[model samples]
Target: MKTGVLLVNLGTPTAPTAKAVKSFLSQFLHDHRVVDVPRMLWCPLLHGVILPFRSPKVARLYQSVWWPEGSPLMVISRRQQAALSEALDRAGIRMPVALGMSYGEPSMATAWEELKAAGVGRVIILPLYPQYSVSTTASVFDSWARLMKKERLVPAFRFIHDYHDHSGYIQALADSVRAHWELHGRGELLLLSYHGIPQRYQDEGDPYGLQCHRTSELVAAQLGLERHQWRTTFQSRFGREPWLQPYTDGTMQALPGEGIKRLDVICPAFSADCLETLEEIAEQNRSLFLAAGGESYHYIAALNDSPGHIQLLMDLVCRELA
Candidate 1:
């Protein structure tokens, strides 16, 4: 049977402009999985207030991390696609790999078409999220289901859900931290920062937060970190609603006062260095900690297209294919 792979990530704007960001936000926020507010109230607020005001501000954040080629997320996803394809080929596995984004260009539909054209009869979908969350992984699955519903003949497919505690993934993450420490020296504290979800989500049995904590614990154990040397926190919280606590920004602000001046922060939730990791954690949080009396802050980059990351992806694919 001819097999193929579809790699998906959260989409990005075509450009770092207000108009582009608005368009992206319109689609992204409209997903019920993302914002559970009833449309009667949410629609007016989103269009009238949130999008109108947040777009310009978010556009600026995107601009800070935009690469000359394109948005950092899209750019890194492309590299990952190419790297995984190359790895598969090296293993003598002739699997066509296509890239997809949940909300924007080169979408799931486009990737499906590419796979169909390649004559794939079986496919594997691996969303770049290591941890499963309704907001992210389920959103990607919903997009795939919407596309498949319209198809006359759906192909055999497998979706890898929540590799958060995958041994290969944990090893790769630990390797990155070790490399960073070797180059810049170890910091006073290691902060494992993940994208935040609302507290209600956890109450609703969303295991995202738990998965994130497990991932951090595994990585920390591999690195032989003491309990006091590492911490897990959440970042990129939106709205005023309470989220998973020990908020990254607030923790960063307070860590310096507690004499944890030198810090190393990593976002295991992100597979690529996007606006969240690049601008929010690396730039914004770095400045916040520094201004709050932090002596030094190092933001460890994401796995991206690293050889180890590629191996991890390959291993995940192979396990399912087998």
Candidate 2:
């Protein structure tokens, strides 16, 4: 059967505007997998309070990091899509490789149509989240399932849950860090800052937290980092309620106070540098650390379309195809 690969990411708003951000956030935050609050309570807060308050502020944040070409996430994701397709082509694998955003344009439906147009009879769903969260990977699956239900003849599907502990992934992360340190100087501490899910989610049996830690450990080990030299933290916390800790912003502030003035941070959970990595970590957290007396702060870029990353994607697809 002819097979196509669908590359999925969490997605970003089409533009850096209040209307766009509001629309994007509305669909994103409304998902039960993401928020998990009872609709009766969450709906009122989400529609009345959170959306009204956050939309403009969040749009401003996106504006600061928006690329001239488009949203940074979307631009980079497109590059990644093209790079993976080229890699697959070089490997003599002729198949459609389409990009889909879970919450925005170039939706799953669009991607499926692209595949269908290419005469694809099967699909390999690859979510870019290295760590599987029900909020993320499963949400992509939910989208795929919904699309399938509407089709009179459903195509064969194979979904990749996560690659948190993949050897190629670990080595790519380590190599990126090593390259960063070689170009820049090594910092006192390497912080693996992953996007946070609620602590309640972990308590309720989401393996995301565990997978984040495992990815951190493997990356550190590949880099030969000592226990004292590396630490795992969580970033981009959403709500007032408890999420993963040590919170990245909090950790940044505390690290300066702890006398670790030189620091390097990388987000393992992010497949591309989005608002979170660019604005939140690079700009906002850097300001927080510097304001708290940090002498130097460095943010390592994500493995976006790097040779190693493309190879890793190519291997994943090849494995499934073989």
Candidate 3:
């Protein structure tokens, strides 16, 4: 049977320009799943106000993390696709692996077209989010469904919603944390920082926050760390809406005053280090911690194309193919 695999991630702007950022934010913020306000109220705020006002700042933030190659999210996601393809090939599995981004370039439609061109009879879609939520995972599904609606031939489909409890995924996360501590020496506390969503999402029955806590607990248990040694917090909150907490920046700023000097931070929610992980956590948040009297602050990198992560992803893909 001809099979194909598609990997998707939240995307980055095509370029670090206000025009590009405006276009990107227009699509991103306009998603009803993302903003949640009615079109009547949200459209004016997004296009008239937010896009005009916020685009430049957001563009600058993207610029801070942009590499010569491209956005870290896109680059790392492509690497993941390559690694997964190699792993599957070595395992005697023959399937074309295509990469897509939910919001930006190499879109879901393009990925689906690639799979169709390959004459795939079956396709497995793996959104690069370990934890599932309506906002993230469901949005991907919505895109997939929209693409298939106009297709004359739709392949048999399988989607891996969440792998938060997967053994291999948990092991990979634990190994990364252990290796970081082994090299830099253990911190006074370990902070498992995850991307935040609005509290309203969870209140409406999104399981993102709960799954994040589970991933944190599982990784800490694997490291044999006590409750005091590690904790989970959320980051990347925007606007005035209440988001999942304790907020990462707030926790980092408060930790030093609470006598937790040395700290190691990891963003479990992100498979690749993007602006949120790089510029926000490693750079901006580092300064916030240090300025607040932190003695030492370390930001552990995400599991981008790491051997263990690659293996885990391959395992998931193979399982789907089987």
What is the number of backbone collisions in each predicted candidate, taken in the order shown? 0, 0, 0
Put the candidates in lDDT order, highest first: 1, 2, 3
Q: Compared with the true structure, what per-residue lDDT tens digits does model 3 show for residues 151-235?
A: 7877799999999989999999999988997899999999999999999999989999999999999999999999999999999
Selected candidate, larger lDDT, 2 vs 3: 2
Candidate 3's error at 10, in angstroms? 0.6
Local distance difference test, each candidate: 0.95, 0.94, 0.91
Q: After superposition, how far is residue 11 of candidate 3 from its true place, in Å?
A: 0.6
> Which residue pairs overlap in candidate 3's backbone?
none
Candidate 3: residue 281 Cα off by (Å): 0.6
Model 1 lowest lDDT segment of ten? 59-68
> Candidate 1 at 159: error in angstroms?
0.7
Q: Whole-model lDDT for model 2 versus the true structure?
A: 0.94
Residue 18, model 1, lDDT: 95
Of 1 and 2, the candidate ahead on lDDT is: 1
Of 1 and 3, the candidate ranking higher by lDDT = 1
Clash pairs, candidate 1, are: none
What's the lDDT for residue 208 in model 1? 98
Q: Candidate 1 on 16-52: residue-level lDDT in tens?
A: 9999999999999999999999999999999999999
Residue 120, model 1: lDDT of 96
